[model samples]
Target: MTAARAAALPGSEAPAGDERLGEILRALDEDFLAVLGWDWERRVITWPRQHPVIGLPDCPVPGCPLAITVSTRPMCGGCMERWRGSSLPLEEFLLVPKQTSRGTGQGPCVVAGCGRPRVTVAGRLCLAHHVQHTSAGLRVLSLEEFLAHPGVVGHAEFGPCEVAACYLKAVSGQVPYCEAHLNRLYRARTAPGFDEAHWRRTDKAICTTREVSLRGMPERLVAELLYGLWVRTREGFKSRPECLRPVYDRLRARQVQQLEEVTDPAAHGHGREQVTMIRAGSERCAC
Candidate 1:
C-alpha cells in the first residue's frame, strides 16, 4: 500500500494489496462523511421515506382533520393504520353515499338559504338536511333548526342494549354493551381463554333468534313455526315463557317429525337424494 493509504489503516499493519487498501479507504471515507452529517443517502437506503403529499384529501373520521393518502380508507393515515388487522371490514371505510340531485351539480341545496351542493341525483336537499329530514320522520327543518334540536336526528329512546337477553336500555357509556354485559365483558377482557370470535358468534346467534325466514312457505304460519322452533331451542329458552312451554314442546315434536318425513333417507337412496335436490332448489328460489 502507498504511505498515505498505509497511515489510514489501523496500527502499522499494511493492506496486502491495492484492492484491500481501496476497500478500506472507501469504508473510512463513508464513515468520515457520516460523522460530518452527510448520511442522508445511507438513511434513505436503510429506512423508507414518505412520498411528498399532493392535493388535500379529507379524513372520513368525524371531527378529524388529517389528510388521507396511501390507504383505501377515507380516514387519515393514523386512523386507517390504527384499524389495520382489526375485525372491522374494509368496506366500512366508505360510509353510506349521500343522496344528491341530478344534472350539472351546480345548484345550491334545495332547502332555501342553504348553499351546499346536492349529494344525490334524486334529492334536492344536501346530505345533512336530507338525513335530518328522513331520520326525523320526514319533518322539514332548516340547518339552524336541526342543529338547535336537543336530540340527534337518528337517535331513539330506550334502544335495546347490545347484549342478548338483556332487556335493559343501553347505558350511555363509551362502550355499547349494556351495563350488565359491559361489566361481564370488562371482567373477561383479561381472563384466560376469552375469545372475542366466540363471543361475537354467540351474540349473533342470540340476536337472530327471532328473525323469521320467509322463503318457500310464503305464509305467516311458517314464520310462527320457525319462531316457535327457535324459542324451544336452548339458545332461545331464556326468552320463552312458562305458559307456552308445553305448546312449544308439542310444536317441536310435530315439527321434528314432519322434517324427518320430508328429509328421511328412504329405502332407495334415490328418494333421499331427490328430496335433497328439491330442498336445495326451494332454498335457491326467491319465492
Candidate 2:
C-alpha cells in the first residue's frame, strides 16, 4: 500500500489530508456487512402507515382524505352513514357539497389502569369507564380522584391482531379481530369469494410506523445497501430506516443492479448524504 493509504490504516493515525472513511470501510469484511445489514433490514420491516406498498387505501370519496378503516367501505364511515340516512340517490347525494375534515382516530382510554379504546375525544374514556363515571354514585367524583382510584382495569392488549400483516392488538380477548378488521369482516361476509382464511394472510396492516420493507429488492442493490448501511454506522452518521427508505425506493425504481451504476448518488432524496457516503465507499472497492 502507498504511504498515505498505509497511514490511514486502522492502527496508524490518519493523515490530515486523508479521508479515513475509505480505510475504515476497507476494514469491514463483506460477511460482516451482510449480516449486520440484514439484521437492520429485518428490524425495519414494519411498514409505515400510508406506505406506498403496504399501506391501506384511503376512502374513495371525491374529497375525503381519511383512510378507510374497513377495506370494504366505499366511502368514509361518516359519509356512508350520511348517505344511508338521506333520501337522495347515491349519485345525487355525492354531488351535494359537504364539509370533509379528516378524522383523528381514537386512542386508549385515559384512566390510569384502563387500556380500552376510548369512545370519543371529549370523553377520553372507554364505554365501560364512561358508564361508571356517569352513574349517580360516581357523578360527584373529581377527575383527579377517579384517576387515582380507577376501579377494575381492562387488559392493555389481547394479542397481536389475527391478520398476518396487521400489528395492532386485537380489540379484546374474545374478539377474533381488531375493531377495523371486525368491521371489514362483517361487511365482506356476503361478498363473493370472501374467505376468512385467505383474508387473514392478505389483509394490510392498519397502524402508523416508520418501518419499510426490503422485499423484492435486487441482489446488487441490497449488497450496496448493506455495505452502505455498515459504513454509515461506523462513521457515526445516523442510519434511520425512514431516512434510508427514499434511497432504497429510488434505486429500486431505477432498477439499479450495481452500486457502480449510480451515476448521481447525490440525487437520492432524504438520504442523499448517506448515498453519497456509500458511493464514496463503492469507488474505493476494487470489486
Candidate 3:
C-alpha cells in the first residue's frame, strides 16, 4: 500500500480521519467486510457501486466539501490554492481568513525596514548588503581579478583565513592571519635576518619523528634523530649538527650496546654459539 493510505489506517498517530478515509477506499474492493467492521448488513448498504458514498465527516469552511487528499489541507484544493496566494503567514495559512496583498510571488528581505525583494538569498539579506559585510569578491572582485592575487582577503565581517580552500575564521580580531600563521609571523619578526628556507628545513628536522628510522635502529623512536640521519649537510650531518648529533650518536651507541647484550655469553649462550658455529662453518668451506 502507498504511505498515505497506510498512514490513514486505524491506530496511526496522524489525524485519523484522512488516514481512515484512505484506508476505507483502499480496502473497498479487496475486503468489504474489513472496511465495514465485518458487519455484513452495513457492508452491503454502504459499499460503493457506481460511485463512492463516503464523504468527509466535517469541514471548517462553510458549505465546502473536503475532497482533497490527506497530504494537503483538509479542505478542497480550490480553497487551499486561494489561501496560498493570500498574505497570511505560511504556518497559520490553513487556519485563518484570506489576507490582502500585492499578490507578488516574492517577499521582502529579512533585514528590518529593507524594502528590497529577496532575490539573491531567499528569506535572507539582498545581494548588495551581503557583499558589503561578508565578502568583497561576492560583488566587486571577479574570478579573474581574485586569481591575479596569490591570497584572497575578505571584508571585515567575513574574517576568513588567507589559505585557499581553508574556511577557518582568522583568529586575530582585525589582522589577516589566523593563530597558527600569526605565530609564524611573530617568529619571523623576532629573528634577525631569518632565512625562510633554512628555518623551514630546521623546523622539519627538529619537529618530525613519525615512521622514521636511523641507520642502525630499524624501529622508529620518539626522538628527532631520524630526521638528522636523512637531512644532511655537505659535512655528512645536518647543518648545525652540534644541536642534534649528540642525541643521534647516543641512540646509535645504545642500539649497539643492546645488540651486544643479546649475543654476550652471560646473557644468551645460544646467540654466541650460533655466531661461533656460523664462523667455523665459513672457515671450513672457504672458497
Candidate 4:
C-alpha cells in the first residue's frame, strides 16, 4: 500500500504516553522512514516499542540532581565514565541554581548574613575581600570545578592508603574528607566492636567458663582478646585506636568484676563446684 495510506491504516497510530511523538513526526518529515526503507506513516506507527527511558534525567554526579535538558547536551553516563581522565567542558552542562535577590532587588550575598560574593571552591574571594579574609566559609564547588581550582587540594578521609582516600573524596562530593572518616569516629566512640569472631568466641567463653578461680577470670583479658581480634579483622584493621576504646573499657569492667569476686570468697563460693564443672567441660570441648 502507499506510504500515506499505510500510515492511516488501523494500528498505524502513535502509542500512548509517548511524549517524543512530536520529534518522531519531525524525523518522519525528514525522510527518516525513507532511509529505513519503510512507508512513513505505516512504519512509524507500527514500530514496536522496545526500550524505555532508564535512570533519572538529572546528572548522576553525587549531590547533584538538577533536571538538565537532553538537548542542552547535559553530561550523560558516557561523559561521567571518562570524566576524571579528560578535561572536557562537562560543567557547561551543569545546571546552576538561579540567584534570587532580596526585596531591595540587590544581591547582598550568596551566603546568608554575609555581604560577599560566594567564594569558589578554589578559595577565590571577591576582589573586595580577597586579601581581607583568608579563611571564609566552605565553598560549594563541583567535582570538575574543584579539581580546576589552584588552592583546592583533595584530602583522603578513609582506606589503607592515600589512593583509597582520594577515591572516597571523589565519590562523596565532600570538601576535605568523605563520610567514612566521620562514620569511623562515631562508631569508635559509640559502637562496640561487634564484628570480631574472636571477640564473640571469647565473650561466649567468658559467659560459660565455670571454674570458681576462672569464673573470676579477668574481664580485661576477654576485652583485650576482643580488641586484638578486632584489629586482626578487616573492619578492625581499618578502625582507629579511639574506636577500640569502648571495647577496652567493657572488658576492663568485666576483669574488675572477676577480681572483686575472687577477693571476696562469699560472692563466688556457693557456685564454685558448679563453676568448676562447667569450666572443665568447656576446656574439654575446646569452647
Q: Which prediction has the highest lDDT against the true structure?
A: 2
Residue lDDT tens for model 1, 181-286? 5566777668788875444223311111111112122122222333222222312222212222222232232333222245343323433433343334333222
Ranking by lDDT: 2, 1, 3, 4
The lDDT per prediction is 0.37, 0.55, 0.34, 0.29
Each candidate structure's TM-score, on Cα atoms with residue i matched to residue i, is 0.20, 0.38, 0.15, 0.18
Top of the candidates by TM-score: 2
Clashes of 4: 6
Q: Give me the overall lDDT of model 1.
A: 0.37
- Clashes in model 4: which pairs? 7-41, 7-42, 188-243, 210-275, 219-254, 219-255
lDDT for each residue of candidate 2 in 1-287, tens digit (9 for 90 to 100): 23543343345323345343344344445554333333322322432235223244455666654544444666656778988999988878767755644333346778876667766434567767777878887768776666666463554655656764444446666766767777777887778988887666555444232344343344345545555655555555545444566666566555566666777735845566767888776555545
Which tens-of-lDDT digit does each residue in 153-262 have in candidate 3? Answer: 33233254342212233544455443444466567757888664433222211111111112233212211121112222111321222223333333343443222223
Q: Tell me the tens digit of each residue's lDDT in model 4 across 1-287.
A: 23554346344343444433322232222232322234322221111112122112444444432322232444433344446455555564333332321111012222223333322322333323333233343245553453355564333322211121111221132322223333443454455655432222222111100000111123223222322222233122222222233333333334443211333233233233323332232222211
Which ranges of candidate 1 are over 4 A from the true structure? 1-160, 164-168, 203-287
Stretches of model 3 off by over 4 angstroms after superposition: 1-63, 70-74, 90-92, 96-287
